[model samples]
Target: MIDALSPLLILLAVALPLALALAAALPAFRARALDLLPFAPLPSLAAALLATEGARVGVPELLFGVRLELRGEGRLFLGFASFLWCLAGLYARSEMRGTQRPTLFAVSWCLALAGNLGVFLAGDVVTFYTAFACLTFAAYPAIVSSGTEAAYRAGRVYMVFSVAGETALLAALMLAASGAVSLSIGGVSASIASLPQRDVVHLLLLVGFGIKAGLVPLHLWLPLAHPAAPPAASAVLSGAMVKAGLFGLMRFMPGDGALGDAWPLLLLALGLAGCFYGIAMGLTQTKPKTILAYSTVSQMSLMVALLSAGLGEGAAGAAFGALSLYALHHGLAKGALFMGAGLAPLARPGARIGFLALLALPALSVAGLPLTGGALAKLAGKMPFSGAAETLVTLSAAGTTLVMLRFLAAAGSQAGSGSERLPAARLAPMIAATLAAVALPWWLFPALSGQDLGYVLRPDNLWSAAWPVALAAAGFLVWRRAGFPAPAVPPGDILVPLTAALERLRKPWAAIHYPPFPKRRSAQLRARGMKVLLASERGLLSWSLAGPLVLAVVLFAALYRP
Candidate 1:
């Protein structure tokens, strides 16, 4: 009986942090809870390290009656994400030391981390969904923590997409579950495997996860959200949070069976578009963190290409490995870049020079210059991309070069006098994360794939990496000579038009189901509308809607249900 309690271990991993975060709500423990928040993710770190291959943990009676399991795939993601969170916690501690409402940040941070690690380790479909939702909602606090106008605007945009995406995901999950009481993702996928309507299920799932993956049109939140958060939060959001979408796609999407013929191709096209789309927008951005955010948008799309390939070729395991490596590489590198960008405002010139030299490693690595972690990830992904995917990948590299060059140019705009230096709290995380990002890929790539590293560094490959960068560099030089002008659009292009359209649409959503509401032409009409609205809202009116009458109705309804 004790041996069967695998789910409890996974449960504890997420629960410990969450409980501590909730403890902050208690006035007596707020301070301690804030302090404990920095260490709350430690258990996840441990499980990732300790869980044996194929070791399984499951519990059915946990949250929302969802069965949760922890397996090897979950362990890999849990390990890296938890480790990233642990470091982020340290960084956050240093940043929030003297700030008011430390618990506010701590609560959100822990919630995000808990949800992140939980989803990766969760065995059942509903369990993963619960954790994924927790992860999405928790990010809001960090997004709004600064309370700046920019932060507020970004947070609002972020909230809209996050909520919409989650709602879509919930609906799609229910569709896939098809009333099955059993909710393990694998089981649900197996059930859906032979279903005739797999096409709709796949499309809904794709859109739901694609939103989180930061695919074009849906990716508007990423640029707004990542830049709005503090440096520590930015690192985790850019590095790890986005990967949850990739993980979800991997876990939920059926890779072994044939779906409708066109689905994989559609996915591939979307992923490729995301890559170039991000680079294009990133190049025009002035904010360094915002630029990196676009880079993330680009990278996520690149991963989706691998996912598309895996789905089409029935090489799902390879896709998993490729996606893992891509996420791991980008998470560390981008995290380091954002952290570094945050710190540059205070760094002394000499320190800045040193940091720039270090920063350049990952920046260029991301451009796929030979021998970098990014290159390793790119190489790992090469197998999946074919024909048109290959072309997009190549062109995306060039565009990435253009965008990265713009970032480097803009990053230097933050200047400090000779005597000034960024706080060690900030500088240390950036430096440490950068070094680890560079080193880990070199170490792990060889182990993951026994392919000759020497060949990767050979003359032809190095030149292949260099030409795109050179073209981009040449374009930068020409632009510099011609006077580099900021692009007319904001950091998020097309988003302005999108926001305007949304504004026009908001009135309809405000009118309840649209096309059905009677016009408010008179007091009587207005009053009736108000009453209907009140009735509708009564269904969703209060967080504490557990009145006796409500409870009786709920019980009666449950008993009366077919």
Candidate 2:
């Protein structure tokens, strides 16, 4: 009887945000909206905790055949995401409290969270895609919070990629619905064995989810988008939001099939490439948040590889559940770390130790270092690897260590940022989140996967975790000793060349927009002056007159020549 109530709770969770968004116009709630946005996820957080450990959350039909459902894995993801939303809410209160229009941001945050958690709870692909699409674009305000040129650019790029990726997912969903399991992710996953268009569907789903997961080439937006937001927002964006992409892949794509083998291999290749690529670029970053963003790219790739391995072995159950936990820990720890980075400038001498301690949790967790949930997350991933995947995992661990160590070094060197006096609302949530990151995995492991907690604390495991950090630290020392400077290349290396090429293309397009089109700065001024003319009376008259004049001239010349 209680089990049946799970879905109702999930629906109510989503309703909280939807209701708040609708009620924003209420004069009484307008000012209170900011206070309500974070707690909007409370229902979801409760559902996540209640339903995560194989809770048989029943599906309730919505529309003709669609189901708004919450399964175990779904509940698990919802739990983490909702928790992040709650934490971010507190952070926003502290950080963005003084902003001009808090309601707008509050509304965006609640709506985005609703959509984010909804995607996971969605039983069918359409519902999932709808929720996902909501999150993908609705998050724009958070990305563009400061409204700087850089912020706008980051938000724009994020919006573009998000649209492209969602379109791909939607198309794939339609195809899956056209003949297969009627669009339910569970249905598709079940019937994927008999599906004729399996390979095509797999690849499309991979690409669609890959874009959000920050897979190479498609990942151009992470470093830009993550650091562009406020500290708490950045925490959730990096930690929880990106996981939606990966979660979509895990749910939508067939985890194991002869035809799907190629897709997993493709995922493996991309994950490995992303792992190394993130580390390479991260080493050059001067900003702690930017470096952490790059580290997310690398670390997330490692988690992707874990899912690929599960798919390779046909352990969909483990694959889905483990990735949920992985996302859970990474989100909390990463959020904490980023939030902690925001505090570097204002921490007192007495508080500095506490702050570094806060920052260290995620850094170690991300590196898969022992005594952290991140280490457990990696240990669980080993279930699917034996030979070559082992080597790949090791390299990934090494890469994560390098990137995180670099991030710490960079963050420590500054000891100061633009902001001062960390707010309690922001500080409290991160601390709570970090504590949760430490304990949740251990608590949930027994019920979710039945893995012994003892394994997480073993000496050999600690040594295994330590070696990667030791080696990376040694390398950092050598590089520093040799006077090797961190690369002076700007954050988002590809943005420069991409921007230059875009300017070149815009020239031709602008030419088409206006006669003689726009060429440069001076031409731009003339176009602004004549924009009215381009669409004005004089412009239409001139075109009409020119057409007849040319026609008359042509007719006269032909007759005279004859």
Candidate 3:
């Protein structure tokens, strides 16, 4: 029956890449497997599409009684994550061909792929943590794949934050698990409130997950890491891997659990701040990838705002539906846009129009243009927002619209210059991913959220989505006519000052290991210190000196009262 095969399908999706990763250890297999890198995610794609409902599977011997399950948001995440991975793999195949050390890239890709898939399917705290750790560490090589100074610097920044986030996550997990009677995610979430230090646990979880979600202050690494990685790796990092953090929030804090009202409101405030902050910073960037990275930060903030509002209203059903829909659409759309960044410069003169069209579809969708996936995602997500919050949500759309327009302008200029044409290997994946971004949401909205297509197509609903984008377009035209200069902020604006501070501390840190004392003074100081220490030791060893000291200490202790 279909039910029995679903678990098997899910297992194969994970096992395929893992098996390939093991085989990559052999020299002959490594060379041959390099060619098959593009196909590594095919089984996962099939599993996502064919597996109907949720299923649970256990692998006791492999992972300490590890349990994996597919259901609800997990299913949606697996579907979209797998879809993006497949598209990225295709893009990588064309981009990485003829490059040295293909096996290195391929193995890293496989490990990351397996870990990304595993995060979505993991059913218990231990399983989820294991998958999360794997994803974090495995993706490092991908970020540093360029082997440039920038790439190495980005890798260090990424590892520093990743390790910090994991420390917080481990602490939170241990706290949540301590009160849990059962080890499954559901059991831990339900039992978290009973712990003596539940508030501390909640804060730690927020910090851990928020760092991965690219919440500000903790978000500097994202822009740095994304731009440093290859296009394929960037696509997954932004589109899929970041969602793992959001997934943790949903899993660990389902139905608002014990977070109270304060946490959700705080998340909302942070989200709104990031929404505008990201756009302001992004406008100054020259690199298309860096611009896209900031756009992601802004978009994720909107999702956090949505989740926070849902928690505030206590409408778990509608909030989760909207969350899943938005995440799914954003992941696909962002993946397509990143892939397009790589292909944009390669558009031939003859196919230039077609290529620009491909880029525009997802770029506009990211702005929530009418009839696009972004519109549906925003619509579904904003159902719980009303009054001023709702108005701000609409205005945030306009701000995103402005950012996307700027991205297109930059990408267009890049397309204007290159002579190389996009070959079929590269072109096919771009087209496929873009089409999916545009059309899949139309199919998925009704299925995932159970809203009639007519509801989304209603005159009022269409107008709600249209006005923000329309206003943004008019504003953009006026701004263009006025000819305001784009501000020049460094790629990681906050990182520059932080790096300088670290540089100032470098000498002090080094001095601890290798002191700067002159040799003559050092010898004299050592001899003098040794002589004083020996004299004091000889005096202390004497009963006459020791007894008086002991008697004085006791008298002091007895008379020490104020």
Local accuracy of candidate 2 as per-residue lDDT tens digits, 255-374: 555445676787778887888888888888889999998888887887787677667555767766676777788888888888887777777655666667667777877787777777
Candidate 3 lDDT over residue span 392-470, tens digit each: 8888889889888888888877784567667777677767877888888888888656688999989999999999999
Worst 10 residues of 1 by lDDT: 1-10
In model 2, how large is the Cα lDDT of residue 479?
Answer: 84
The alpha-carbon root-mean-square deviation between model 1 and the true structure, to one decimal in Å, is: 6.1
TM-score of each: 0.86, 0.85, 0.89
Pairs with backbone N, CA or C atoms under 3 Å apart (clashes), candidate 1: 6-57, 7-57, 7-58, 69-123, 346-422
The number of residue pairs in model 3 that clash at the backbone is: 0
What is each predicted model's overall lDDT from 0 to 1? Answer: 0.76, 0.76, 0.83
| Runs in model 1 lying further than 4 Å from the true structure | 1-9, 32-34, 64-66, 179-181, 417-420, 446-455, 502-562
Find the 10 residues in a row with the least total lDDT in model 2: 51-60
Evaluated at residue 149, the lDDT of candidate 2 is 95
Candidate 3 residues lying further than 4 Å off, grouped into runs, are: 507-562
Model 3 weakest 10-residue run by lDDT: 547-556
